[model samples]
Target: MTKVTAQLSVSLDGFYAGPRHDGDGDWMASAESHGFFRVTRWVTEAMSWRERQGFAGGRQDVNSEIVAESFDAAGAYVMGRRMADGGEVPWGDEPPFRAPVFVVTHRPRERLVRQGGTSFTYVTDGVESAVAQARAAAGGKDVAVAGGGSLVRQVLRAGLLDELELHVVPVVLGTGMRLFDADLGLDEFEGIELTPTRVVPDPQVTHLRYTVHDRTPLTLDDRGAGTEKA
Candidate 1:
């Protein structure tokens, strides 16, 4: 059984993307504040690899530590169409995964073969099907959910997430997409807050780690204490 984890970079105001995300998303979002650029460069650099096949964005100390911690743990990645640009991936065509990647999309398309050892497999049957495919491809490591809002919402709603690693960029765009855009709510797990790291330029970017817990409510005894029954 593989753990399903969501790693996202959000602003201090709790938004992943800022303003209008036209093709100029990165450039415009970066100009919003020094923290934004710091986080962006950090995230981009975190995914960069020596093979030049994965996302080769600029590097950052914070992102390097965080990404290096998680990227290698997964056997496959599940992403939304918006994040499918050639760069965000680690390997599409050799070394990183050499495994299948399931992408959720409304439009249908053939598999994409990239320079790296990665391939994009488009899926439209919905989140359940995508997760199934990802689990099957993942073998036993983990399934990483690359976000675009809707996919994360779906996975969260389905109660399929095992952990979440969020990076707070420390800037407020006043508008844009969000990480938790779900329509429902449930106390599915008790999350333990991990260490928080600050980023460069403005020193506002923060990264938080949490582990997922799924357990049934405990039964109390008549004396208002936990029951000791087998």
Candidate 2:
């Protein structure tokens, strides 16, 4: 079966990117300067990442192997409009994805064909629609949710995410956009369960993979609230 997977690199404090400021100029450049670069340094230094970006040399360690594995597993991708816009110029003519990318947005736009096998198809409806389109395009491989926190949260809340991988870096950003924020609305429910499937410890970062479980509701009685299995 084709699984829906998501991967992200975060700081020790659970922040994926630094806090956004008004008039911060270019969002991408500002994020890099704030702490995005520090959080994702491991990925940037990976040989697989460098090769995908058309760069020559990089470290070919365990981290590089992990990066390569992720690239190989994903056949299609779903991302938010903001992420796509921010990455458009940086990704250049031939983006590393090399597969069909579904962008969830409110605006409607024609399909964008790029160099290599990469192409962008804008989905105007919602995240579910984007994921459905990606699943159809995956060709038996897994669909990756390439995100910017909010999109990932939406997928998680909608119970569409199957697997999640977090790359925990050593550095700590005092203030930034947290992956698991109050906006997630998970606090109201019993919360989703995650079964740790894999753990890879490295010098630069630690990779943790988890299998997401369906949320189980809390059993309420005359006395108090208790837990119950799904």
Candidate 3:
């Protein structure tokens, strides 16, 4: 079985992309050490999807372990069009992702092939279809929801996501895309559980994991241990 999980970095203010994201780079641009490019490169190299997608070298810096662990069991990846460079830059020399990369978009484009083992597969259909295809490609491994926020929101809104892994960067951009900014009624999710995690710097930046219980509502005794119901 394949699981769908949304994983991304967020700021203290709960924003993923800043107001100037359109003009500037990404939301993490204003933070120290950024970890923007670093994270992207790390994610690509981390996935089992990388075997067929694309990858670039010159990385292997800090945070490699966590990056590697993310996809140690991942089978494939999916993301919104914005996450696909917004169809801008042609994913040139060192492209980031390396799985059976599925891009959700209404626009039509030819299949994209890149360096270091990667190819782009565009899906015009909705999230469910993408999840199905991703699972097929994942080969029993987990499916990761790559995001620029919109895509993750769409899946979450539809109650399609089963998990969420967040890596928080301690910064107060005050304005940017947020992981859960748009109201996604909590009721839609059953057995919603959250686990708090901290790294060397504690709150400076932390990694959290959320798991959704089966769709049906459950009683208190039905809740699993180590899960802080949301």
User: lDDT for each of the candidates?
Assistant: 0.65, 0.91, 0.65
Highest-scoring model, TM-score: 2
Tell me the spans in candidate 2 whose CA falls farther than 4 Å from its real position: 21-24, 28-33, 187-189, 218-230
Per-residue lDDT of candidate 1, residues 81-187 (tens digit): 76675334433345354556788889899987655446789998888888888888887988988776667877876777777777777666666666765453544
Candidate 3 global lDDT: 0.65
Clashes of 3: 13
Candidate 3 stretches greater than 4 Å from native: 20-62, 87-90, 183-204, 214-230
Tens digits of per-residue lDDT, candidate 2, 12-79, equal 99998888644748755676446878888999999999999999999999999999999999999999
Candidate 3, TM-score vs. the true structure? 0.69
TM-scores for every predicted model: 0.68, 0.91, 0.69
State each model's C-alpha RMSD to the native. 7.2, 4.5, 7.3
Model 3 poorest ten-residue lDDT run? 32-41
Residue 155 alpha-carbon offset, candidate 3, angstroms: 1.4
- The digit string of per-residue lDDT tens for model 3 on 1-230 reads 78888788777666665552455555455542243433343345533334323544433433445666665656788888876865337466445455677788898788787765456778887778887888889878788888867788778767788888777666666654567754555554454444443433433346666775434554457457778778
